[model samples]
Target: MMYKADHKDSFPEKPGLAGLKVLADQNYLSDPAVFRNPADAKTTLAGELKALAPNNVSYVYFGALPDVPVAPAKMPLAFERPDLRLNGNLCVLFGDGHVESLTVPVEVDDCEELVSYLHTQKKYSEKELKALSERAHLLDGELGL
Candidate 1:
């Protein structure tokens, strides 16, 4: 919210993980540890964020927010992918700053199922593909999934 107030009531141009970097740089979200959701013990941000883990924070961020004002419930800023996080529901952060847990159908606890799901996405962007690929490889080598 403070970021919006300073940036003409708009969000960072970059979407997803990169966009979160902006907030971190601006001190809006200072603690890098907070980026890693507690449920996601297997994944962690690389480089400066290294914390006895590999990769980046977990969550599918929707950074390209709509310009026109709309109901907060309709604007989902970020959501947790419970597949590898070992959670049965998705923890979503809405535009209104409210978090909701939505039940999903994925086999949350099984790392093998999570890897399979990442590989079978119908239409994933290059970023998604890279993330999914890295995560899959990590699971294969580390977790023996």
Candidate 2:
């Protein structure tokens, strides 16, 4: 939030999760350990504290976040990458600054889960919805759903 406050409510825009470097580069966060999940042993602590590599990071930064969204609580910011998720659940960081564990469900779930939940439950504007879907597709592919 501090970074957003300073940077006109925009996040570090980069491909996939690499944008997280903005946090360290901009000094919002200095430690790479902060990005890792303690439960994930596969991901090692970065030697140089950079999110540039997927193996060293635990989460995927969804790129479709709006500036000062009206329903921040309903938006998905970032989530634990599929391999990092335990027991078929991923921890999601919402726009409201809350974290939740989401059950893994493929489109076969009828609801198609994940992105479907965002579209139906959140009701973001057309532009925001398009952005969210684009980013969510990348994440869904990683999750294999």
Candidate 3:
């Protein structure tokens, strides 16, 4: 609301999860409570909030634009409830402000593809991506990707 009111009904400049903390610090949001996911009991924003650490944030932003001009139905704004095995689900927030929960099959190929995409986008360094891929299987239950 604060962002849209100031930016002519536009969203924030970046669509990353970290941006939420930025907004909170800037007073656009009352606090970082909005960043907390219900399923993640371990995460909190009471103390100093750091986007890089993310502590317990369950959702991942999909590189949304500042103005958010993409098609509402197709664009995935964020997702959560990630698991690698045993009925893990992906909850997606569409561009239209609608939430949908879908079962996304987590396979080795899918994980590899996502790692490649993240590397191409420079979300992490080559070394980090390599390490993530190597430990992807071990992190199945704990990984948020």
- Indicate which candidate wins on lDDT: 2
Residues 2-117 of candidate 1: C-alpha lDDT, one tens digit per residue:
88789977767555556677777788777667677776776764545323232556654556434333345445466564445444666667567788675545554433344344
Give the alpha carbon lDDT tens digit for every residue of 3-114 in model 2. Answer: 7679777666553555677677788878888778888987888877653477777777764354535466877767777555777677777756799887765332311246
Model 1 worst lDDT window (10 residues): 110-119
- Tell me the number of clashing residue pairs for each predicted model: 1, 1, 0
Cα lDDT for residue 22, candidate 1: 79
lDDT score for candidate 2 against the true structure: 0.65
TM-score of 2: 0.73
Per-prediction TM-score, please?
A: 0.60, 0.73, 0.55
Question: What tens-digit string does per-residue lDDT give for candidate 3 at 1-145?
Answer: 4555686755554444555655666776554466666556666554444543445455554434533244555444555525321255556665567776665446422334443533443355455555545433333323443
Cα RMSD to the true fold for all candidates: 8.0, 4.0, 8.5
TM-score of candidate 3 versus the correct structure, residues matched by position: 0.55
Ranking by lDDT: 2, 1, 3
Model 3 residue 25 lDDT?
66
Each model's lDDT comes to 0.55, 0.65, 0.49
Distance from true location, Cα of 94 in model 2, Å: 1.4
